[model samples]
Target: MKFLLVEDNLDLANAVTSRMLMDGHVVDHAEKIEDAKLFSDTGEYDLILLDIMLPDGDGRSFLEHHRAKKRDTPVIVLTARSQVSDRISLLDLGADDYMTKPFDHAELQARVRAVLRRNHGSSQPVISVGDVSFDPVAGQMRVKGTPVKLRNRELRLFELLINAPNQIFSKQKLCDRLFTFDEDVSENAIEVYIGRLRKHLEPSSVTITTHRGLGYKLDPR
Candidate 1:
């Protein structure tokens, strides 16, 4: 999943960003409310981890504006406020969940999965594409009940494809989703990853098809 992490503390932001990346999710970090708004304007994130106390403005205002625009993207607010009223207020502001500061990384990850599952209306963690099954939360893939050995890049590519099967992903979109803001990716990096993933899925009923001048889509063979 792609996420926008709106945090002002460099230490907390880096820690969360590292853990999310390790979990095979693309993340963009913003230190101020203005920066967060800029990233949110792109409409590329599946989720947003918002810190209530931001440099430019409080997160509640952002959430209020976002919901007013009818954006359904799920938001998990991170704040130090432990009052019940505060939590309720955040929810009323359209936050899907709330996590207090000094929270565990594992707990945060689990909450992220829960929120995403609810958004996608999935009762289980595994998303299946024909005989190919992918667990985004577990960062694992299996073909016909057998585990498939894949490199990190290959797994990331497959995850994106399986999550939105049949949707065409352009080369530029793939590159932007796979690489972080600081990482330097080659022009053909996405092509190489797609080539590898295709071979890995060859034995399964799932197929990745190129759309000539367009892009690629995954479908059941």
Candidate 2:
């Protein structure tokens, strides 16, 4: 999953980002409210990990602003304030979940997955496209019940396509979704990954089709 982390604490932010990367998630970060708003405005993240105390503004206000604009991306508030009232207020103001400071990295990761799963309408752990199945949490794919070995880039492209099947996504959109802010890669890289994915899923029951003027989509025909 791709996440946007909004925290002004540089040390904490780096630690969290590193752990998330180790766990195979793409993470982008913004240290202030304005930077966070800029990233949120783009509407790219599957979830937002927000800190209540930012440099320019409070996180709750940011949440209220985004909620008013109808941004439904799941948000998990990370704050030093661990009081019951604070938690209640955060949830009441439209935050999806809450985690306190100095948290267990594993618990935070689990919370991220839980929020994403609840938002995406995924009943089963595995998402199926034709005979192929993908596990979003584990980043695993199976073809006809046989495990398929996919390169990291190919897996990321397939994950994005399968998660939102039938939704046509342009190459640029795919790049933003699959890579983190710090990772520098070319737009042509998406095409290369897609081409490799087609070869990997070859002779399979599923198909990834290109829409002439639009982009590419996964069709389970």
Candidate 3:
């Protein structure tokens, strides 16, 4: 999952970025509302972790504008405001969830998964195509109930594919999701990861097929 973290505090942002990176999710951090707005306009993110008291502006305005634009990417507000009214207001403004400051990382992770699951409209947490199954929260992929050893990027590529079975993803789209906005990618980087993932799934019925011009899709063979 790619995330837009609209946080100003360097310590919190670093911790969050490191945690998400360890979980194989790409993160683009912004320290101010201006920067967050730029990222919001330019990047496609699975979720947004917003801080209400930003350096430049309140996050409520950002949320309002985000919803005004009709982008349904789930958002989880991270703030120090703990009042029930605050939570209600934020939820009414389109926050998928809320986390008070000084929260546990585990709890935050669980909330993220819960929100994503609800947004994706899937009550089931694990997603599978053929023999390949992935638990997005656990960041684990198993083939025939046996865990497969995959590198972070390889797992990310496969996770993206398995989540939406048989959906064609253009190379640009895969690149956008797999790599961060600042990372330099070669023309064939997606191909390289696809090749690596193919080897891992070779024993299973899941296969990554390429369309000459349109890009790649994962389907059961």
Query: Which candidate ranks first by lDDT, i.e. highest?
Result: 3
lDDT (Cα, tens digit) per residue for candidate 1, span 24-102? 7889998988888777876478889999998788888888877887899999999999999999999988999999998
- Stretches off by above 4 angstroms in model 3 are none
Worst 10-residue lDDT window for candidate 1 reads: 178-187
Per-residue lDDT tens digits for candidate 2, residues 1-221, read 78899999999999999987876777899998888888888757778999999889789888998899888999999999989999999999999999998899889988887887788777457889889999877778898888898876677788899978979999889988888767789988887888888877886898889897788999875
Cα TM-score of candidate 1: 0.91
lDDT per model vs. reference: 0.87, 0.86, 0.88
- Please give the distance, in angstroms, between residue 53's alpha carbon in candidate 3 and its true position after superposition: 0.8
Model 1, position 47: C-alpha lDDT score: 89
Error of 2 at 64 (Å): 0.8
lDDT of 2: 0.86
Model with the higher TM-score, candidate 1 or 2: 1
C-alpha RMSD of each candidate structure in angstroms: 1.8, 1.9, 1.8
| Structural similarity to truth (TM-score) of each candidate | 0.91, 0.91, 0.91
Instruction: Assess the local accuracy of residue 138 in candidate 2 as a C-alpha lDDT between 0 and 100.
Output: 74
